[model samples]
Target chain A: HNGSVFHPGTIVFPAALATAQAIGASGRDLLVAAVAGYEVGIRVGEFLGRSHYKIFHTTGTAGTLAAAAAVGHLLKLNPSQMLHAFGSAGTQSAGLWEFLRDAADSKQLHTAHAASTGLMSAYLAKSGFTGAEHILEGKQGLAAGMSSDSDPSKLIDRLGTRWTIAETSFKYHASCRHTHPAADALLQVMLKQDLKPSDIAKVETLVHQGAIDVLGPVTDPTTVHQSKFSMGTVLAIVAHYQFAGLQEFDQHFHDQDICSFRDRVTMVLDPEVDSAYPQSWIGKVKVYLNNGEVLEGRVDEPKGDPGNTLSRTEITDKAMRLAAFSGGASPSEMSAAIER
Target chain B: HNGSVFHPGTIVFPAALATAQAIGASGRDLLVAAVAGYEVGIRVGEFLGRSHYKIFHTTGTAGTLAAAAAVGHLLKLNPSQMLHAFGSAGTQSAGLWEFLRDAADSKQLHTAHAASTGLMSAYLAKSGFTGAEHILEGKQGLAAGMSSDSDPSKLIDRLGTRWTIAETSFKYHASCRHTHPAADALLQVMLKQDLKPSDIAKVETLVHQGAIDVLGPVTDPTTVHQSKFSMGTVLAIVAHYQFAGLQEFDQHFHDQDICSFRDRVTMVLDPEVDSAYPQSWIGKVKVYLNNGEVLEGRVDEPKGDPGNTLSRTEITDKAMRLAAFSGGASPSEMSAAIER
Candidate 1:
């Protein structure tokens, strides 16, 4: 997790589902494959370290190998074949952050490429197509080309003993993870003071450098997808609507009031937060009211984090809301599917 | 063309052909698109500089953009759309040298992925899928993330004035490009001396650091593909037979005599050659005979290089041989196609 923020589910789930369907695998097999993908991808992200996330997109790069691990597990590949799959997947590891500057559609493409390419790699390995043996830490491997701060130890730290999938957090706000900490902290202040959107004249978020590195580029977001990366936009949406859900982002991200509130927000780099970062994302914000009143808010664990994880009921509700927003399924069908 | 050795045709031609066939484009259209691809890919590889090629495979990383340029040109994309296509292609640029260490099949996969992905980027851009505006030189762009010695000026230098497509080389030997210079030098020595394999006791190849960096890992190549990267093996094949072509490598690469000759070959880094590399590949070799006599051989330009390019007749012969080797076409069919 380090300085890198990625949704392993975006890469792993697609690969697992695709492989499971292709192979007629059971639901239990899919779950096991998903776990394998999560374990490999999360550790690979950690292994790549902070420097890699600075330039390379971890979800695309490490995600490729993660996808291979999942698909390979589903295929019941031998250890040798699995290593070969990683090698091929690592060779194809790619995705840069430049697209964020233009609000490009590359983010979605990255996940698709990772999942498909990784799936292909596992299939190739099963057919005896050899690949590099040491693609992760080798002299000319992914870390050698993509990361300056790679730690080989992170790749196999606890192995079977540690289930890193549990460490994954759900997104409470339908926005960038970098904004969630600040979003939660702002919500805490609003609830405590019973403050309305018009009550707070200015909001200052004290965040780690990682937030700025990722969220700093979007000065004026033109699209809903891009606005999610804008710290100010997320905070403004949450302040006005109480939640930065898909509907809020879709309909009101560019609304006049939200845009005005967006301009009233700023991010300041804090040393304490930066130092504790990756390991822990601590949110601290300062609020200035029109009545010459100032209030500070802090949230050590943002909602949906492991420490403040969502309950089954909350997850179910969130799933239903997502289905409704996307018009993916009717309520009865969604409930039936969820129950199954 | 600098320190990076790539077969631009491997990426560009495939993409151009695929796009042209899909769209029913003219042969002239395919030719122009290929030229565009070659120009963009070569410049990108040169701009990335030697540092990028050290770890990243130039053909895979730069080739993706090249493929995109070719396909984009074939699609008749406007400047903005072409730029967007490049942005998407660059974000997905990837391939590592670690695969070479294991004689992996990733090299073929790299070209396939680049060609397909690049083609897809062009189609996406045509559909108004926006990409980064300045993907190559942007803060989190391809160069920023993949290369430390990237030169921004080289990307646009000479623009329409210089036709880089003319600079591309044909591979005279079936082995890696790094081995070609020395292979030619060895051929020169053997021909001039009119000596057989038994006449040579030991041979030392004077090469650039790039050659050593690429060929140093294949100490005892077990596969025919791996043997191509082995400096010792390539030299051995060339010494025993006048040429190291596909047939020779396939059938005789693992022969005991060839393996013994492989052990007798050694590579020594030469300062003059190292400094002049990328721009010029000078071959210098020392051949020690069993009769206690030594001879020096030098070749300023390797066979198949722009300066010493193959003639049309030789090219046709080579194509026919290739078709025969792969059983892809009959001699008459090849000639008919070549005539067209």
Candidate 2:
């Protein structure tokens, strides 16, 4: 959720490096271009959309432009030349919608391509090549071609005023957003009822339609990637385990008990719940007891939403946990760096 | 333009650095993530149609997801966490249509944002946060939301077979692609006609519809960025000068003759030529003489296009020229590097 404030250094570094090496741009120019690129990239991207999930992936789409701008700015190109850089990047724009399929590795590649391609575009423009000027607004322009709905004004919207980097969200969980509420809810139910896996007969989950479509109807996930998308699998692990974390997902994805429990769990989809969407990732879980009793609990908002936002302390704690897993830094050091 | 296989290090280095630092990721993991990210990002992006310019900016849109996936992979998060990382990135996705709007700086920003946000998303997910799993395939998924025409299967079309990095283009010019054909055409006309600027009165350019829509309606551009997008500006400089390279773009963007000639040139949009489109970035230029004589030329393909692609020698020559402008390595050394 990038709100505002573009940091060109973010995209510039990558773009400039490639361009510099490509056309033998000086190292000094590369460094300067990198910083400038990030600033321009972030600023422009911020103007487009921060939380518009459906429109485009700002980092990939806009990042290329920023990279090109940084290179153009560094090379001291005229405004028209800069426009060619934009056109070059636009013609080469790309990113995919496959991450949602199974969270494949392509997600990470998007950034690399943008950075590399953008720098290439700038270098080409700098060398007296030409590109489209109306690449974004023409009949087959970026807006008309890439996005269904675009406010052309957004391109120049607050050109230098708002930055997008400021609004970006920092994650504390490694699971799907749709599943966080369920995880939190299950944890709470287990804590309140003090129940063990042995006492539970069947677990029923009611969640937003979006979540159901994404994480429901879990049968059997053979791979680690697929297991994370299975609501049934996630619930199975939570019901039988003390804590649900990265280790649980990685280690028990194919465990027999987890698999068995996943099959026993039933997920119900409700559109009414999905209406709240990103604002409140809501979920409800019912645990049927062997004694003919049903204990129901609902988590209307997950722990990371703005309403249920994680405190600074919570964020740091989570960062520390991840750092520990990566085996690189201590929680305190990670926390300090983030705070700074 | 990047159609051959080259070292991943060249492209991966820059993208990885921006991605890691922007998201507060550790430097140690950046390199590993970058390599892996490049492999995944390129492959996935290529699958989505590397040759098509209509769907989305593959490098920008798909690149973000690739960056996110790389970061997630480096962090070793399960599928659920990776999905969240991608979802976070999806929500923040965007790039401008302004490239077509007089070659705005938005083009460069596209790639920069993708790299930055992808890194950010992964870092967040690593911190034990959540995001949607069906970020791409859901009803409001990336494909459905951003693109009117998308092939979801393209996401994993050839998962591990082909890599996108191998198909990347390394540019040899600093101008717009549309103007490249015109530039070549003008240069050819100059060589053949041996005509001086004093002999030319009016320069009329005929180009494809895409070219006219993008680079036509040329105007006086103040910034170098803007000048690159102006076909008139590019043609004026190339037609008037004996040498055209990076230095001309950098040092002479505001030269009086270039500016004055830019004011005199007119670009006409030809509908009959529009049908050729992406296939042939064709261009025809007519120079009307003060003595009632006419010198006309047409280029069916530009130097960078597949049919008229630049040879290794040409690429090196361009690189050398850029090096001379940057006052760094000689063209020979730069050329060697590119060849290497």
Candidate 3:
């Protein structure tokens, strides 16, 4: 929501799976609950507006309400009960961006806490527990406490007609979503010129303000995970390898050659890009070559966006690679789980 | 912290007991952990200031850090790890006043989640997990997201010289702390005048803004828990029974006579009380008798305050009565547990 990006699945899936399994729910029931969670979570995130995203992590704050919606749906709660769940969930909504400055594991804990707390809210509501009915728009509410630019209409806009779950994007590059546009743009310029990393004198990414706000903190990333948030590192990997994947980040993020390339990359705020942001991430980059020639590359939609989505095969391959990298499952095991 | 009143034991004791039992820590260690939790939580709560208290629940927001401090101490974490735990805990600090509007059970969930989440953060930090080192005062931290009137000095005020744990008050009335001053004052007026419930025509309470902010929502409370937040209900019980204890609230809170008395009670804002409030809750009430006689009562310190603490015997009796009321423990079981 707004300019901040986070995976709704991190919170919703846990709540859906837990509630579904506990109640012996059908697969169709689980899927419906998941969709409801995404819709409500996304709407809430959007409602909180830009000011809220500047400081609070939407995934953690809105994720609680999303998780509750999914569980409440699965439980077949009455309207009043569902509202109580929202009240309970909203009261406990919390997450901040401070941890990003330290590359903290707080991101995982935030989603985990949101999922569990939201699930608990649904269960409590089922037991006739009361909660604030006007929690979202009340005098003392989520927006009142957390946002300066909240819009109530964003919550119910296109309500049943629009499905926000379909709008969620896949991560094409193994980096922060803020860096994806620039990474893709850099790769485009490098591919068009048939040039190597050494041929580039400087590369300037014409970016949005949100990108700067989120990615500007990491001047010198020391860890692999932290390096993913550094726009310079992501653009450097893209310029050299064409694909800023997990392997590239893990193996060469801090390579002397990559670091040298990273130093050459800079982010410049562009009015056009800033205006289009959150709604549309417009990628525009200027590549200055050693031969005194400047080339421009632009992409209206970066890869993995709704308009430029990944294929089913690409999704499968990405999932398999991630599973293999973590050693979470073997190839056959992963395939069997996916099939199930 | 600020003008908000919350039970520190609700968040601290659970975390300390859980960690102590999990690690098989000594009784002294557990006690030390609880104290550490109280000191840090109280400091953080005070640091966030009055603006934070208006919308957020102090126990829930500051409780996470307090719980983490206690658990981290028990885990023998290094300074760096302890700092990381604080960061993780701060990122998850959340609770809102919205739920109180509906007499919600969210209060219990808030403390429960704080205890568990804080415990988890400490464990994660112990395992080398990094977190924001400046979560309390960072640009995108707790104060930035939650407070408009935060004072950093409150966090370090007295530091090692004074123990905030010593300042926490016990509840003398089975009602919201916001109503205690008025309840005590009303009881005093009736006692001084040798008046029965039938003799009083009206009771006016001079209260602080914080009390109004917290207690003003319940115009006509319907539940036992909700009635505790109604100044009128508490004062009415006090006028009738000379006490607003658990039994009084449970049995007579909704009685016809009590309801009639409740209608005559009113709360008016007082600048003197407001200025001294949070630091010192002073009670002042005016009782207008049926015969046109007026009696005034005042108390600098209410019962169960640090200046007017309950005796050991009273504390024991209160505990036994509470346990018996909930059927959580028998008298023998309560005595044995207390002895152990």
Per-prediction CA RMSD (Å)? 1.4, 11.6, 2.1
Kindly report which residue stretches of model 2 are placed more than 4 angstroms away from their true locations once superposed. A1-174, A183-204, A209-228, A242-253, A266-269, A285-297, A303-340, B1-174, B184-204, B209-218, B223-226, B247-252, B286-297, B302-340
DockQ (model 3, Cα): 0.75
Tell me which of candidates 2 and 3 scores higher on TM-score: 3
Clashing pairs in 3: none
Q: How would you order the candidates by lDDT, starting with the best?
A: 1, 3, 2
Q: TM per model? A: 0.98, 0.55, 0.95
Clash pairs, candidate 1, are none
Question: What is residue B207's positional error in candidate 2, in angstroms?
Answer: 2.7
Put down candidate 3 lDDT per residue, A171-266, tens digits, no spaces.
Answer: 899988889888888788888778888889999999988788777878788888889989889998888788888899999999998888888889
Q: Supply the global lDDT for candidate 1.
A: 0.90
Give the candidate number with the greatest TM-score. Answer: 1
Interface RMSD, candidates in the order listed: 0.8, 7.5, 1.1
Q: Report model 1's interface C-alpha RMSD after superposition on the true interface residues.
A: 0.8
Q: What is the lDDT of residue A309 in candidate 1?
A: 90
lDDT of 1 by residue, B231-285 (tens): 8889999988889999999998899999999999999999999889888889999
